[model samples]
Target: MIFTIAHKEFRSLFSAPSTWLILGVLQFIFAWFFLARLDAYLQVQTQLAMVANAPGATVSVVAPLFGTLALVMMMLIPLFTMRLLAEERRNQTLALLLAAPISSGQIVLGKFLSMVIFNICIIACSTIMLSILGLGTRLDFGLLLTNALGLLLLTACYTVLGLYLSALTKQPIVAAMSAIALSFGMWLIDVGSSDSGSAMRALSPSAHAQSLNSGFIFSTDLLFFALFIGAFLFLTIRRVNNNRLYA
Candidate 1:
């Protein structure tokens, strides 16, 4: 039953013209940035040639590539998330789902799965650009994998949060604005703080994602991502059940 609902929701994502347009633009940006970074690497290769045996030089070049992936996700997720529950409620389809035999948990999970699958496509498309970098120089394969994993977790968290926000509002624009604002606020707080004094930075998803992206797969980061996603999703299910009760 869950799979049936998830399959339906997944297919429905393609019905929007904006989804295709946004995807096209996102792919272009990924390709452009990867090439730009490659060109910069080539330009610096000459200077690097002079610094025979510079310590941790390879790490410096690779770090920014992973960082670029993080930047792309931060921008793309908000746009996708805005449409999740907000669009359904705005058009009154959420009530339809609530009235159906499906439980609130199943409905929320179905929507979340659909969004996660869409995100996988985006990440897969971006990999082509990253692959092109491999031909020019040997890149750290593990770093790339870690970077991708971090992005998936981070995006999942964003989707959950967006879904929760969408359930709280009837207006799609309001949901979008609130979700984006909250995400951006967390991002800035996480980034602007010093790592040494980052006791409070643990509250932000981006900070935790960065730790994982840097190949530091700490348990705290994993637990945080899981808890963050689970908490929001649980709240969404609660909201859906409550709405049905009052309706």
Candidate 2:
């Protein structure tokens, strides 16, 4: 049942012109940044050779690329997620969905899975671009994998938050703005905190992602992402159930 809904949502996304435009623009931006990073690395290649334990191309280029993508995804995902449930409610289709035999969890999970699959495509495209570096230099596969993992988790967090917000309102624009504002607020927590061990900083997904961005994966960071995603998914499911009951 979940897969059925996911397939429907996935097809819906592809059918939309905006999805194509976003993908095109994102690919162009990724390519531009990759080239710029490669150029910067080349300029410093000779200097790097003389230094001991110097960072390689992966550290100098790929890591920063992932970092930049993280921020980009933080902003871009709300646009995709805004219309998930909000548009359905606005169109009076959500009540139809709620009346169906499928459970609320299935509805939420299916939509969530659709977005996850879409994000995987984005990550795959970036990974392919970075894979080209293997031809000219040694790439740290471990670090690359870690960055990919972090980005996936970070974006998943964004998706669920946006999904919940979408469930709360019939206006897609309002949901989008709310998602972006909350995301930025969490980012601000990470940025504004002065102490490394500050509890407030730990609340930010960006803060947890920093460790992964640096190629180190701590269990705590992984747990934080798990809890964050799970919490939002639970909340979204509850919201849908409420609609189902009240409809």
Candidate 3:
């Protein structure tokens, strides 16, 4: 049942021109960034090649590229999230969904997972670009995998937050803006600490991701991500239930 709703939402996203426009812009940003990073990386590689001791691809250059991607995903998700619930409410389709045999949790999960899967596809596409990073360099596969997991965990948190915000508002624009603001606020909170404020970063999903970025995948880090994703999923379900009550 949830899968059905996810399929519908995923298909609907392609039907919307604005979604395609945003996606095109995302592609441009990624391409531009990848080229720039690779240019600098190739230069650094040449310089390091002069020395016998330097590794082919330094973590310094590679980690920042993935880090940049993590931040970009943080910004891009709200664009997809806005229409999830807001469009349904605006078109008066939500009532139909609510009236269906499906639980509010199912509706919420379906929409949320659809966006999550869509995002996964977007990130999956980047593997080709990241593979380019590995072609001539001795990149650590395990480190890359760890970073990918970190990004996935972070995306889960952002998607649920956006889905919940979309469910709260009837206006799609308002939902998009609110979700972006909220996600950006969380990100800025981490930025303000500059990796020095463990208290602040520890609680922030962005911070947990930075931990994985450093290749230290602690049990606490895994627990934090699991809790983060679960907490937002629970909140979104609760929010959807509240909407049903208010209706």
Candidate 4:
């Protein structure tokens, strides 16, 4: 049943013209950044050869691209999630969903799963551009894999928060704005923290995402993401379930 809902939601995304427009803009932005980074790396190749143990293509180009994608995804996810529940409620379709045989948890999970799979496709496309570098020079497969994993986790984290916010209101634009405000506020915590182990840094998903982007995966970072996603999903389920009382 969850898979059925996910499939329907995935198809619905593509049925909207805005989804294609956003994807096209995303591709253009990512391409511009990738080319700029590659050119910069090329310009410094001569100087880098003179310095022993200098950073290579993987360090200069690929990792930063992942980091850039992380930032871009942070900004884009709210738009995707804003309509998940808010639009349903606004259009008066949520009541039908709420009264269905399926549980609230399944509906939430299915929607989340659709978003995750859509995001993975976007991430995979960005990764292909990075992979082109491998044709001419040796690339760090392990590092790329780790960064990809990190992005997936980061996307999941963002989606869950956006989902929770979407559940709070019937106005999709308001939900999008609030989600972006909250996500950006948390990101600011990372930027403001001077100490690596500060409480503010620890609480920010952006901080842990940077750690994973460095290709060094710690148990602590994994734990943070796990707890973050679990907490939000739990909250979303509870929020949706509450609708039953008034339905």
lDDT of 3: 0.80
Superposed by TM-score, candidate 4 places the C-alpha of residue 199 at a distance from the truth, in angstroms, of: 0.7
lDDT of 4 by residue, 1-247 (tens): 8998899989999999999999999989999999999999999999999998998899889999998988899999999999999998899998888878999999999999999999999999998888999999999988888999999999999999999999989999999999899888898898888898898789999899887788899999999999999999999989999888765
The better-scoring model by lDDT among 1 and 4 is 4
Candidate 2 lDDT, tens digit per residue, 65-153? 99899889989999999999999999998877788889999999999999999999999899988989999988999999999999999
lDDT of each: 0.76, 0.94, 0.80, 0.92
Off by over 4 Å in 4: none
Query: What are the RMSD figures for all models against the true structure?
Result: 2.2, 0.9, 2.0, 0.9
Arrange candidates by lDDT, highest first: which order?
2, 4, 3, 1
Q: After superposition, how far is residue 7 of candidate 1 from its true place, in Å?
A: 2.0
Query: TM-score for each prediction?
Result: 0.91, 0.98, 0.91, 0.98
Question: What is candidate 1's lDDT per residue for 144-227, written digit by digit as tens?
Answer: 677778888888887788778888877777877788888778888887897734677888888888876677788888999999
Return the clash pairs for model 1, or none: none
Off by over 4 Å in 1: 50-62
Looking at model 1, which ten-residue stretch has the lowest summed lDDT? Answer: 54-63
Query: What are the clashing pairs of model 3?
Result: none
**Candidate 2 local Cα displacement, residue 211, angstroms:** 1.0
Count of residue pairs whose backbone atoms collide, per candidate: 0, 0, 0, 0
RMSD of 3: 2.0
